[model samples]
Target: MKKFLRKNRMFLSMCAIVFLLLCTVRTMYKFSIRDYHVKTNKVLGYSPLERAMQVANYLTNLEMQKLQKEQERIDFKYCGGPCRFINVLYIREQETRAQLHVRHLAFTSAKVNRTLVLPNVSGSHLGACKSHDFEYYYDMEWTRQNKEYFNSIRMKDFVAWIRERKEANVPVSDQVLSTFDLDTHVDPSAVTHCFSGLTKPKSTFNQILKWNITGQTCELSIQAREIAMVQFLKGPSLGNGMNANEDIEVLHMEIYKANQWSQMAQSDIPIPYHPAVIKLADTTAKSLGPFVAIHWRMEASKNTNNMLPCAQHLISLLKRKKKFNFFLLTDYPHMFTQEQQEAAMKGVSSTSELSQWLQSNSDSFLMTDFTREHHEAIHYLYQHDTFHVLETEMERGGTPPDHWQIMQIPDRLKLADVDRPRMIDSGWLGILDKLIAMRSVHFFAGQKGDVCGRSKSTFTAQIIDARTIMRKSRTNYFGPKNKTL
Candidate 1:
């Protein structure tokens, strides 16, 4: 028995070592499991993998919320609605009157809780249907910031929304685009709802669904599923008994009444010139140093038949204020060269007389007298490719075609014939004149029978109104009681 035990001793030692090692491994594993559970238990009773999943879910929710907030902000700025819209058509009017028209329509939109679709601005009365961006004439940034006063979206944005609706298969009834000429008396009960497949003519959205106002009345209210587009045939105007169209005056009053109902202050209405134009005017005014601006408006004057008296009256007025330089803004052919002036005089005898008067008053500066750099700046800022196209088409001895046709011409070919250096177009030049006249130390306009006599022109009225709003007066420089000469 002792010999057998000695022989098996090696085997017994090997088995014992194996058992001890297994026990040590099992104990170590058990402690590791317990430590892992303890660490996990401290973290809201979740295992490591479960806790990681929980953190991922929390971050995802935060991201989702952030995306939602961003969408809401975009919706507010661009007016992504669940809402209705109103657009104005400023046809057959100059830009000054058109600007007022827009303001009145914007007020109407605000009062009715509708988004105003800003109309395209026209630089020429002839091209009333042809339009440029709202920014071409006014400060769009100012408009955006002052959304509380005028809630609006650009013409392009409105068009995009319409296209999106069509793509999304929004019901034809839901996407109704209608036009209405607002009546003098706004009867809330006279609501009209129109529906049609959208037809955009010449890229003007307001002309989208041309429905005649043959029997329509003042108010146009659409159903919850529909959108409304209202166009004004005649725009709101200030009623001073100078014009017989009291209908516009009534419309203007309705807007004010709506404003009163909505608790909007009249002071909140925005000024109508582009910020760049205003800035340029202010700078030029400072450099001119106490100059008097005279808006002769010879084209509108009734005294054009016998302009010698009118010119004499203006000359005498300037003689009285001889201490200050004169800035003349007239519709006559004042910017023509000697050869051009002679040619123009041959066409219009009255223009020749007005030109001689303007030429005699050499102290008076015309817009052409501005620096070439300043003229270039005006050209660059307000010049549109469309203007160049129109001018080119006109110079070729043909009436300019529709906007779309003009745009279809290759971009390279449009400006080939245009004289890019000169501010030749009346559209941009009118704006430049307005801004310069607006910033003058003393402003003078034609009164009926005064030297610069004419009917009550919106151009003159706008300048006076702007000056009043800006608190521009002769009193600022210890001058006379009247702000206008």
Candidate 2:
């Protein structure tokens, strides 16, 4: 053999190499076949429903290429229950499968005789579970019939009934409850006592009491009032009868308005504390930029309950941004508690006060005097050093105003005529339109005064000059035809 190998060493070596390569290729092909096994790849050709079951682990074993059935044999070794059964239902809708059975489902409201309705099962649906004896008992005809006692029935049937009732607009009440079988005559006290004994106190009375007293007190007090307000202000819930888009649009408008007001508060320039400097700045601020001063006044009836709600609304809208320094010039500072007032001013950048100056008979005899104070604020804003009113009267009058926008006049109204901190003019509407069109700023205040107080001199003075500003204006700035107005 040694002599033969020496004679044909190259030929023998070549033969050995070819044999090793063939063996390696064969081994690799076999391994590749095992790696790409059907169990690993899953059925790419199955229907969507078939694929879903496979993915969900419902299919246990493939009996044939076409007939794959779910593995329903739950391992009973875990529980000592008497028996088990696998109940399968074929559902046509994707929704039914997603919401599993046995979750919201109740088996029976009562045992043998007395039946009662289980209302808790109304909106909730069933969930899937695996068990031993429970499954066998659940499969029994007697057990299925007894489920009516608990209002726990087949989820598919229950869903179908619910759908019918929904289409009929039948209310969920005793009538609806009657559809389910419940043992009304069952003595609940014995069972209830048994369950009660098993239950433990969740927490100490003191802990729960503390939370109820403190945590929920604010919400409880205010939530009831808010609900009442919604009833009073917004009317009724029209439900599905109302156009959803229209409702959303109106809500959006309110949200936008609120946000804009909040933004205005942020942009508002505040007066410096120094008297001379404050005075100088107030006059110059408005002049430097073409901005308007908004003098807004909120009034509640004397000894009225309106103060809290009104203040809450105002504070909610005002706190969004520190756009403007709100000189909350008010008459009844006493109406709100100090804490409430402080809360309102928490994020407020600055506060300036022009006293309400209520005279001895300000309510009636000196009503005019109270009005003067409001007008003075407008004048203060127009020429004040802190606010810069950029637009000249001629220019302002000529320009069309948006719906809620306004501009002010300087040094025209007397101190006695200032009624509110701010005033709105006829030109305000047009001004608001302009602001909306330009999206220049969220809001601008032209003048702040009582609209009802027509003959009132302070407002009249500003309105008179504003009318002249309107007259000299190239556009019909104050008229209905004005685009901004």
Candidate achieving the largest lDDT: 1
lDDT string for model 2 (171-264, tens) is 1111000000122222211111111221221211110001122233334543353343223222245786542122210000000000001111
- lDDT string for model 1 (169-272, tens) is 43212221223233334223221211124322211122122222334321333221022222222222346633222122111111111111112344235445
In Å, residue 42's CA in model 2 sits off its true spot by 11
lDDT of 1 at 147: 72
**Each model's TM-score, in the order given?**
0.48, 0.17
lDDT of 1: 0.45
Off by over 4 Å in 1: 1-79, 124-131, 144-146, 168-197, 200-272, 339-425, 449-455, 469-485
To one decimal, what is the Cα RMSD in angstroms of model 2 from the true structure? 28.9
Per-prediction CA RMSD (Å): 18.1, 28.9
lDDT (Cα atoms) of all candidates against the true structure: 0.45, 0.26
- Please identify model 2 stretches exceeding 4 Å from their true place: 1-8, 11-15, 35-266, 269-485
